[model samples]
Target: MMNWNMTMKRNKLTVLIPPTPDNVNASEWWPVKSDVNWIETVYSDNKPAPSKLQGVDVFIGTDFTYEMAKFADKLKAILIPAAGYERIIADALPNGAVVANASHHEAPIAEWVMMVAVALDHKLLQSHKTFVTGLWDHWPGRYGPYRELFNRTFGIIGFGAIGRRVAKLAKAYDMEVIASGRSNNHSQIAQSLGVKYCWGKQGMKEVLSRSDFLLVATPLIPSTLNLIDEQALASMKKTSYLINPARGNIVNEYALYQALKEKKIAGAAIDTWYKYPTEETDQPRPSTHPFWELDNIIMTPHHSGGTDGTRNRRAQTVAENIDRLTSGQPLINVIDF
Candidate 1:
């Protein structure tokens, strides 16, 4: 049996400690109903989020752990805007507090993969760059040395929310989609999404070897860190391309750069990077990134899921969770320990 308390006062808005992404903010959170109270970033000034948790029953924001650890006594529910709660210190959360995650938050991100895949397949960026560089009149190498999505073997790694979405979209492009995900847990889920699922280490090798385009959508876990490296890339067909809209560290950056430089695989489009924007967000990626020097690699500013509609989705989730907060219904996306 569970004992619940409702003594803490309720608020209408999601509190953002370190405001969410613009794609998320503009797309939804900030534009929510006028009655909500959203506390914009909590860490820009070297402070933690706990400074403001007193008497607030609901926390609709990101990275609430440091704040939770410092101010656990007053919290009722914590609903984060991001799908992944890795930024929060989960183990340290107070025993009485409840949590809700945003699983569908990956929609924008997974959709970004589809866009990048199209760009790579059509060689859009490459052709446009060449045209702008004074080669506008004539194009070379078989109309961009392009490839089509039809009949291509598209392999999706980590058939969780994002990977499964990517696979479904790939099918619309006429791609033969096969997915490898966490062992035993998501096989039925993958099949329901129209993907052929393979599990564990062997599954990864099989998918890597056969895929014409490989998409890395796995999270950054100990077992998944550097999951794609020399041996894995070596197993891939030299004509295949890799797309990572997921975490950066999942694929070893140096190994990938070497694979591209050596032409081990066709090319890659990388959205996530080893280094992120510091306090400042205007600067371009660092020179240390190997993808910057290689035309074969397409490196975006970690903007894969940064379309303008993301914020709306976030706020809606927050709102619905707030509604459910009092209803005592099971949360839609709670991350279990």
Candidate 2:
């Protein structure tokens, strides 16, 4: 078992769970309540009152705004139920508080990535749309031959947990997997997975130019923002398809739109977006550009990894961490700013 210096003297820990869409019906999956030592409090709104947050030992939510932090006087840990911590204002967190995130989303997200890759390569959505409209242009004899994933080069940017999972799945399809990251730290692991890995600008160029299907799986950080700009997009093969299950800004929004409009690349599958619905506007456009006008793109509302399995596993992880906090054990997946 892991160990930590900090331990709660209280018999029970108050865990405040907000009513975010991701946290819907969380009581069904959270296992800690049965333990009797953990108290689970479900807030009615995404933004809870200061009174709701006071004395809370744990806050189980994704968005940790400054306002939430201002009232979190007794918070021990802010356990995000998901991997992405970009929404969290780490600077706003109170002293002695630790932030942690969970990652059971790799499998589901990899599945979505591969699914969309095959769909894009096969032109499945386009074909379906045309065929359903009584058009026979997509007929095997009428249309040009479709591409198969077999023996194709699958390039991945940011070879982290999700990228590793994607590489395994792509390899299962007999794809030639090649990946690049910020450093050579995961080089050996990539090699063991039969992936050709490299780093630096030259490595990125090699992956971009050679891939039949390229995947963006890196996190959104300062140096990584707009990593795939107009110049980077121009480096890709015109027939290659881009798959981004990562953040939207990682690929320039306007640049991506322009590329698709000009057929700079064959197509793209984008899950994350530049714009999202806020409290005032529940249905704002996902981007400043009209990507929906393009036929060679596949878009989803950032839910590729929001699977039931991910929810259950994350809930278990949060429960385990809370249990560890009460038991004076070191937590897993702790994030340091």
Candidate 3:
């Protein structure tokens, strides 16, 4: 848990950002190491010199709106500092610019999903609010006004690394875990982790209907965008809860808002952003963002996978990948595309 500033002193990393990290002074990233060239600021002005990039090994930037490929010829790899890289660098991303999704940022993100799942099953939002207002509550005296995970069904929509981790933790809660994803491979991992099979569209509907806790973990792609819209929400039990730590765009905000407003389902925990703060002017999110007015909707500032140790972990990964490329070794976690 050393400071990025102090740790960076011996290792200079040039970071180009239109916007920089919110914490710590911007100066900390520079002057890290004597031989380290890790010095960069958000490129808001003139373009970087295309001819002088021979020493740069790693590129950490917001997005390549700044003609990244020009500076990438000698770059070993382009590391998208942000977790969601699906929308970054669509056109020209220099040849052999091995892409790695920010896996280092996923731990806190998965923990957020777990927290929401636990909160929903225990009915924290509604019950805790009452405990404060002196609105002495009565739940028909149901033994489980707060449900227990002991024998409940937990369903995860994506079987990627994040979803797999979610399943492992859920099973430890004594819950039956099921996940659906790109293929049956998810179920194979689930089976090994003491989870059951639930794949494909129809199988997913059944999984949705059967789950006491449903998590929207799928990626936001052509086939998956708005995948859990009206019908998927309808397929879920009114008693069930939802947790989405995936891309906010993956779940249609309007559909979710409508479901909660109408009480079509229990409640939801949402992280990620359909819209993020853009531009250099530091403005607040537009008031029109749907979640602002929904009490049943718990909103997070995309801090799910954000932890104190995040930068160090990400930097370490970048450091390794850089070393590998310099040594002419194969890179790790390279996305085929």
Candidate 2 lDDT over 26-87, as tens digits, reads 44556664232234445433455656677787888776777777778889898888888887
Sort by TM-score, top down from the best: 2, 1, 3
Candidate 1 off by > 4 Å: 1-49, 64-68, 105-107, 136-145, 280-288
Candidate with the larger lDDT of 1 and 2: 2
Model 2 bad stretches (over 4 Å): 1-9, 19-28, 33-51, 279-281
Alpha-carbon deviation at 12 in model 3, angstroms: 12
1-337: candidate 1 lDDT, tens digit per residue: 1232223233343443455665665325434333445566546423345666665666765565554567655677778766656556677777777778665547788777888778876778877878888785326454544568898899988887788788888898888888887686888877777778898889888899999999998877668889999999999999899998878888987889899998999889988888754454456563365577787878887777765566567657766766665455566777674
TM-score for all predictions?
0.81, 0.90, 0.79
Per-residue lDDT of model 3, residues 1-337, tens digit only = 4785665453444443233467754334321223334544444322344434445666655355335566565565666544556655556766665666457665677778888877766666767788688765725374335557888888888877787888878877888887776667665567788877777787788788998888887767668888888889998999888898888777777788889888898888878667666545665663245567776767777778777677666656655655555445687767555
lDDT of each: 0.73, 0.86, 0.68
